[model samples]
Target: MAAILKDVMSPNPVSSNATDELTTVSKKMKEEDVGFIPVKEDDKYAGVVTDRDIVVNGLAKGSAENVQASDVMTENIVTGPPDMEVEEAARLMQEHQIKRLLVMEDKEVKGVATLGDLGVENAVETAGNVIHDVSKGNGNN
Candidate 1:
């Protein structure tokens, strides 16, 4: 049987509100020691904010204090179910050229799967391929 995401993913990932200021999101990132954060809106999982988003969209634009999480969050983020196979999730990450995969269930953010997770889970080959492809920057950024 294939390893599922729940086995390797970090559960109950930290999240932020869409209406939250970028400063708030940055603090959350710092407190959680995570670069990625799921975003919520209207009590629903809406999007994601990353450290890069804060730098590129928030800081690069204007005062980060004035920017909301929604202002820098990636709305069309790719997601997968907690039960998804590790190999399948790796493929998805390679295809999307993204480093992280937001694990979702019942429209709620369950956890996050990352290349490092794959490596830690003994999916080193898959993790290597994903890292290589994502570094190529071929997918939509």
Candidate 2:
């Protein structure tokens, strides 16, 4: 049987509220040592705020102190089920040009699967392909 997302995903990722200030979320990211955070609205999964989102959308737009997670979060996020095959998850990440894949089950956020997670699962080649594909057209980054 193939490995599933649940077998390699980082479970119970720390989350932030849509109303949270960028400063607060940045602090949380520092504390957790993670660049990504799932954002919640009304206790429901709403979007995601990444370190890039903070710099590109939050800091680049206005005073960082006044910015909220929702102000910079990446909505229309890509998501997958925990039971999804790891290869499928890699394909999904590549297809979306995203480094992280939200794991959802029954309309609830369950975990997050990252390229590093896939690499650690012995899918290094697959992870590398995702990185290459995502970097394409991303431009000078």
Q: Model 1, residue 6: what's the lDDT?
A: 92
**Model 1: per-residue Cα lDDT over 52-135, one tens digit each:** 778877899868877899988989989899999988887788778788999999998999999778654555765666557745
Q: What is the C-alpha RMSD of each candidate to the true structure, in Å?
A: 2.7, 3.0
Q: For candidate 2, lDDT tens digit of each residue in 79-140? A: 99999998888777766777889999987889999877866455576566655764564411
Off by over 4 Å in 1: 120-141
TM-score of each: 0.87, 0.87
Going through the candidates in the order shown, the clash numbers are 0, 0
